[model samples]
Target chain A: MDLSTLTYIVVGATFLLYIGIAIWARAGSTGEFYVAGKGVHPVANGMATAADWMSAASFISMAGLIAFNGYGASVFLMGWTGGYVLLAMLLAPYLRKFGKFTVPEFIGERFYSKGARLVAVICLILASVTYVIGQMKGIGVAFSRFLETSYEQGLFIGMGIVFIYAVLGGMKGITYTQIAQYIVLIFAYTIPAVFISLNITGNPLPQLGLIGTMADGSGISMMDKLDMVVTDLGFKEYSTQLMGSKLNMFVYTVSLMIGTAGLPHVIIRFFTVPKVADARSSAAWALVFIAILYTTAPAVGSMARLNLMNTIQTGPVGEATANLEYAKAPQWFYNWEKTGLLKYEDKNGDGRIQYYNDKNPEMAAKAEAFGWKGNEMTKVDRDIMVLANPEIAGLPNWVIAIVVAGGLAAALSTAAGLLLAIASAVSHDVIKGMINPDISEKGELMASRLSMVGAIALAGYFGLHPPGFAAGTVAIAFGLAASSIFPVLMMGIFNKGMNRQGAIAGMIAGISVTMFYVFQEKGILFIPGTAEILQWEGYTKSWFMGISVNAFGAIGALVNFIVAIVVSKMTAPPPQHIQDLVEDIRVPKGAGAASAH
Target chain B: MDNNASKYWQANVRLVSILLVIWFVVSYGFGIILAEPLNAIKIGGVGLGFWFAQNGSIYVFLGLCFYYASQMNKLDKQFGVSED
Candidate 1:
């Protein structure tokens, strides 16, 4: 079959499977919509959680991030996975025992204040919306690459598919759909990786292939060979640190941890398990599922780096000196070239493409001696690295089709999860909890469906007009969650002395500070001239005492904690029953029959 | 007057402290502050510190959770607090 037909068949079939699951498992009641009736099996919940967690960020961008950044990007691997450990140990089981429909509901009830719940609703919306934009971009990239549509057109198509199932199925529909998505995505991600691994290192497992022998008989280390390639190209050694400061890395990692713990979509996954023990087990299982991707990413990165470098820069696998523009570039090159992600410039009057580091003019001199002007890969977008991998290695058409379907599965699954989270927070927490206290469960469910529609429209708008840097948008989302939601929930569950006033104040403070920092950096939103006064570019580079401003969420969280603690101390203590409520949550014995409130 | 309840709490705290230590060591310990010193060691052509940063800490975290869960289950039975 032709590439276009093959891709269309795979993508179309996957969408049908998702919509079919959404219809078959349509959420019947409020309970079913919110927490899948609190009866999801541990393994199934794990897979669903993994799908919810991985997002397009994990599937498409992670390997590209690692491939470009080398070892430093490991923070993403460690921080993201380490977050699950925190979730499993510190939050999930207790939150499950507290037995609420949403993270904010727990905060509001535990803190005994509507104000606190409202603050949580705000934070959840902000974090989720920003993160969804990244997913939308991923969908656009996948659609344009596979279907040959323009990016805007691709986003519209992506949004239309999400609306069908997400509006119809809700959380219950999403959970089962996510399970199937997890399977497709994992298969899509791994198959191409294995093929590349075999071709490059003669090892089928990309994880082991990462450290295996190079295709060349030279016996040099893979990292060493990689270091030599980029360095030869006038770039810093692959092992050398370039942009970010160490203090900044530490702060960034910590920020990610806090952000991961605070995300509404991930936290809500814990609510699906029947018992507190199951919740705990599910958290670990979620990590186990997530680890499959986390572990594979670096292997993919290393292998892609080696294969890319060997194919383009040097001899056919082993020789030191190879022609720069051999026209031998794989089909993946032409495919991605149409997307403008791959480009060529014949600098030294040589027809071959030279991809050396332009930063090092001295090395450019050596390459120029060989009639090469400079490096040719000017627009190699990172997003193309994963989706283009199979094509890069000349894999079969089905494998390429599967990657397209996989990318869609990842984006759609995460978008569905986020949309459900937004809808529930609106209906369950903001509306039912705040606006209409007398509203019945049935009415609230209706309100939820309405909210889902609204949220999808909003996401569609962003997808059409995506921000300049999609990844930067995701970082801000993380910062918002870190600063706002995580702190409020943590204090609510663990600290009995916290008052409603303090909880509300802290959340507002955290969210506001993080938003101010983000808005200040991106001046396009407001009148550009005043951006210097309101915005702080330095925050991204360094925060208080030289920490990355992304860590502002953690600091904002700290402010909330301190303010809440101090205010609670100055005021009257929490009532005796509330104190006892905290204790009850700690004990997991009667968790089986617990309320799914 | 329940010996088992006190015993359970004691065991729980002890196990939690131990696991937390391991967690902090592998993540904050090996990945950040001690990374340069630890990178001196190599495993399978990668630096030991880099391996820990990328994969080792996560494996340890998973192991830690299982250990904690099993021990907690044991403590629950011992303290007459097993889930019904």
Candidate 2:
């Protein structure tokens, strides 16, 4: 079958499977909608959590980021994965023992203040809405490429599919569908990787293939070869290049780790499992599952870089036939060009595609010596590395089709998870918990569904425009969560003396400082023309003490800890009942069965 | 809190501290802070630091999670607080 038809069939089949799961696991009550009736198996919940955590950013964008950024991108891998350790150890089990339906509920009950809960809800919404926008953008990109539709139309279709399962089945439906999605996405991601690995290095595992010798009669290892090839073209060495300063990388990693631990969508997944032990083991299981993809990512990235460089440079630089003829470019090159993500302009009227760091003065001198006016491949979107990998390696059409399905699965699964978190925070925390304490379960369920639709519409709108925000806003989301939600949640669990005033004060202070830094750097609320100051010319410089806005969360978190501690010391201690509640959450025993409501 | 519950909680905290220390050492210590010095040592075809940053630390994190779960469960059993 043709590539387009195959993509449609594979994507259509996955969508139908998700709809089927939604029907099978249709939520019957508010309990089911909110927490899947708290009966999910540890392994099943782990799979769902993996699906929830590995959004479009992880599946679609991360490898490409690594492919281009080289060693600097390791912050994403370590930061994202390490945060799960913090979650499993510090947060998930205690939250499960508390047996709450949402994160805000825990804050509300623990701080003994409706005000604290309301602040938490706002933080959760802000972090999650920004997060969902990225996922929506990922969905649109996947759809636009595979379905051959405009980005806006693709986003609408994605929203329609998510609306069906998420609105009907709630967490219950999303959980099972996510399990299916995890299977589809992992298989789709690994199969092409394996094929490409064998093609490149004769190693079946991409992980080993990354460090293995090339199969092309080159005695040198793949990493060494890649380093040589790119550097020969004036790019930095892949393995040894530092990403920003060591301190910045340290702070960025910390922000992402804490951010991952605090994302409400991930934290709430633990609530779906049957026991506190399940929550603990499920977090482990989730990381185990996520690690499968995370470990394979570096291999895919380095190998894809090697393939792209080889495709363009066909031979050693300075040689007459070093560049690939523009007229005879490979099928994968043409395929991506049709999407306008890969473009070639012959500035020197040359017929060959010159791919190099034209910005490098030394390389520019060499190009000038060769009578080349400039780099001819005008644009190569980094996102195409994974999507175009199979085609680059000439894999079967069916494999290419699976990749499209996998990308969609990744985007949709994460979008549904984030949307559910946003909806539940509004309906459960805001509406039922506050506005309508006397609201019926049926009414709460209706409110949840309505909120899901509204959240989807809002996310879709942002996805269309994608504000002048950098692609790395995934880190920004983590920074917000780490600064605002994580510190307060930790205090609620670990420090029983934490009072309402301190908790609220900490949240506001943390979120405000983090947002202020981010907005000041990116723009006010990321509006294009609203940036108070512009980025430094020639080089990206840190705003405060060599710390980029992306890494400001650690400082914000520290500020929160100090402010909360000082305020708590000055004010009255938490009530005895609140203190008792804290003690109750620490022990694993008598984690009462999740209430049906 | 009962003596047994207090003891169990203490054990949990101790175990978490140890594991988190390891977590910090591998990702932040070896991967970032000490990355330059560690890059002198090669593991397979990659630097030890890069390997930890991309691969080794993630594996350790997964192990830490399971290890913590098992240890905490044992502590729960010792305190006679294992869920029925």
Candidate 3:
């Protein structure tokens, strides 16, 4: 079938699937709204968590970051996947055993103070709201690409779909729809990767192909080739560290792991399963689901790099000489050209467009030797690599359509889960738990829907505005999550002595310091002179002592633990029975032992 | 409330400590500090460090989760805390 038709069919079918699930599994009460009634199977919950965890950033941008950054970006793969270890071992099962609907509830009960819970709700909202903006932006990109609508129109359609599914299904509907989405996204991600890998390295696996020999019979390794491309183009060697020291990498990785563990949407998935064992096992299952994409991503990056480089060096597959003219570029080039991800400019008046960095003295000499002026590919958006892979490699249009739908699936699935987390925290934790204790189950559910509507609208507004950098902004969201909420939750679970005062203090300190650093660098939120305020030499490489502000979670969590301990000693500990409750949560069978207070 | 519950808690803490040590080592240790030394060796087409950053740690993470879950299940049983 034609590309346009296929795009509609795939997107239409996925939309129908979500609406069907929403209608079939509409949430019934506050219980269903919060925890999917604690009845989701381990496998089902795992799929949902995977879908929730693998946001538009993961689906749309991670591979692109990896492809461009090469070995340096491996921090994302390790930090994100390794975070599940923290979740499974330190958090998930106990949180399930605690049997609470929200992270803030645990804080309220653990610290024996409403103040701590309120602080938690605030942190969760900040982290989630920033994170949701990335998803909305992704949705707009996908819709505009596939539905052939303007980005603003796409944002509206995406929001409408999310509003229907999220407000109606709550966790119940999202669980099943996410499972379907996981399948769509994984298939969409892998098929093109497999094809590209086979074409490039004579290997079907991208992971192996990453380090595999070059098909060109050149003595240089694949990494060496990548190094050549960027260095030739006024960039650093692909494998060589362009920025950040070892310590920063450590802090950054820890931050991502803790942030992943701290994220409310993912944490709430543990509450959906039936038992403590299921919660524990479900984290394993979630990792397995996540690994499908995580494992393949680097492979995708490596293979896509190889494909792109080869395309520039030679004319498509089986051709010898380089094709410099705009007319001779493949259909994929033209297709992606419409998205503004790929473009060329003829410099030096050479018929062939030289794409190497003009600033690189060595590569400049090579280009001069070849009678070329300078680099010609002006704007190559990295994110397009995964989304536009099929078209690039001469794959079918249906495959390209599948990718569009897949990107949307990735964005929507994560957005729904995040919006739901935001809503539940607002309604169940703040409104019901704090602002109005006597709020009815029905009223709380209504509040949840209203909050969902509000959150979706806010996300849409940001999508229209869009932060300056997509991947970097998404990293900030992770940094916020890592630095703020994860640490508070960890202290709540492990340290009986941590009090409300300490938790609140730690969260504020950790989140604020991290945000200050990032804002100082980005100058975002219309803050004037943010750049001059926090000036440090080697700031790009050093990024707050070479710790990606994303590592703020470990720093935040550590500070929370230390501050909580110190403050608890200075003040009084949580009530005695709260310690008993901590003991109760430690054991697995205690899952059913504690009733919702 | 009883000895069994205390015993289960101790055992759980011990298991968590061990698993967490491995988790930290894989993610922070080999993948970060020792990554250069590890990268001296190659896997597929990438360095060992890069491989861990990309694929190996994730597999180990999977193993760690299941290991923790199974160990916790046994602890639950030992303390007569099993829901089953």
Candidate 4:
């Protein structure tokens, strides 16, 4: 079968499989809807958590970011995975033992104040909604590229698939469907990686192939060869290039680490497991699964860059006729160009593609001697690097089709997970806990379903008409979770002295500081990440201690810890019953099954 | 009972603090702060520092999770806090 038809079949089969799982695991009660009836096995929950955690960005764009940034991109790999360590050791087991639904409920009950819960709910909704917009875009983009549909049509299809499973089954449906997604996405990701690894380094495992010798029999190492190839073309050495100063990389990694732990969707996944011990072990399993992709990412990145460089720089650098002739460019080049992600300009009218770091002052002489005008390839969307990997390596059509399925699986699984988080928080925390204290169980389920629909519609709208500052969403989302949610949760669990007043003050202060910094830098509080260039330039040198806005989250979290501690001391300690409640949650004994609000 | 609880809490906190120190050492310490010096030493065609940044820290984190799980299980049982 042709590639396009195969992609359709594979993608169709996966969507149908998700719907089938949703039907099989239809949620019947509020408890089932919110926490999958709290009966998910540890291993199964781990797989689901893995799928829910690795968004389309992880599956699609991370490798490309690494490809361009080189060693600097370590912030992502370490920061993202390190959060599991915090989750495993500090947060997951205790939260599971608390044995309730939704993060806000815990905050409210622990702090003995509804106001604290309200703050948590708003933060969760904002972070999750901002996050889901990115996922919606990923879903739309992946669908458009694979199914050959328009972006809107692809987005609607994705929304439909999520609606059937998520609205009907809730966490119950999402858990089983996510297991299927994990298997599909992991296979989709690793299969092409194995092929590419073998092609370049004669090794099937991308992890080992990354550090293995090149297959060209020069006996040179892959990293050594990559450094030589990139630098010869006037690019920085691949293995040593930093993202910015070391301080920025340090804070950026810390921000992402705590932020990952703080995310409401990830935290709630632990609530589905049967035992506190299961929560701890499940975190290990989730990381094991995530690391499979995270470790392979660097290998895929460096190897893809090598492949791209060799394809363009067909011969020795600084030599005439060294660049690939545009007329005779490979099929992969033409295929990607048709997608508009890869564009080549005939700079100097040479009818050849010269791709290098043109702005590098060091390379100007070499470019002038070779009569090169500039880097001819004006646009190479980083998103294309992973999607076009199989094509670039001349892999078979089946491998290419599976990558499309993998990208969609990543996007859809996370999208459903986030929408479910938003819906449950509103229904459980707002409607049942606050708005309608005597609301019937059936009525709340309906409310949750309605909220799910609304959340999906909102996400879809943003996806269709993404703001220009779409790139800044990640920073803001992670920053809010890190500064506001994470510190409060840790203090709540570990420090019995943490009072309602303290928790409330800390969240407000932390969230405010984070928002203030992001806004002051980006220049928009109402609609952040939409900063125009002129305003962005104005705040260029305002970073405190050379820390960029993206790296200020760790500082915000520190402020939260201090403010909460000081406020709690100034105020009364938590009441005796609240102290006993903290003590009770600290132990695993007498823990009940996961219950609804 | 309160005495046992306090001791158990102390042990748990101590374990977490120690493990976190190791976490910091591997990621921020070796991966970033000492990365320049560590890059002088390499394993199998890659710089140790860059490898730690991208690959080694992740593996270490997995190890930490499993270790903490086993240790916590022991602590729970030791403190008579294991779930039914």
**Candidate 2 Cα outliers beyond 4 Å, as residue runs:** A470-472, A533-541
Estimate, for each residue in A1-597, the C-alpha lDDT of model 1 and write its tens digit.
Answer: 998999999998998888888789887788888888888888899999999988898898889988888777877887788877667767888888887788888887788777778778887887899889889888987887779899888998888888887777777888899999999999999998888878877788877776666766778766667777766666666654422666666667777887898888998888888887778778788888888888888888877876677678665312335754556766677767777877776655556666767657787677656665556777777777788788778788899899999988998899989988899999998888878878977887789889999999999888887656555777788888888887777777667678777777777777776666655655544335544777445444344556555556666767767777777787877777877777677667677643534
Q: Write the per-residue lDDT of candidate 3 for residues A315-342, one digit (tens) a residue.
A: 4321224645566777777777778888
Q: Is the docking of candidate 4 incorrect, acceptable, medium or high quality?
A: high
TM-score of 1: 0.94
Candidate 1 ranges with C-alpha deviation above 4 Å = A240-243, A316-321, A326-328, A361-372, A467-471, A524-530, A535-545, A592-597, B1-14
Question: How well does candidate 2 match the true structure in TM-score terms?
Answer: 0.97
- Candidate 2: which pairs clash? none
What TM-score does chain B get in every candidate?
A: 0.89, 0.96, 0.92, 0.96
Note the clash tally of each candidate.
11, 0, 10, 0
Give the DockQ-based CAPRI class for model 2: high
TM-score winner, 1 or 4:
4
Q: Which candidate model has the greater TM-score, 2 or 3?
A: 2
lDDT of 4 by residue, A370-433 (tens): 8999888899988888988999998989998889999999999999999999998898999899
TM-scores of the models, in the order given: 0.94, 0.97, 0.93, 0.98
Best by DockQ: 2
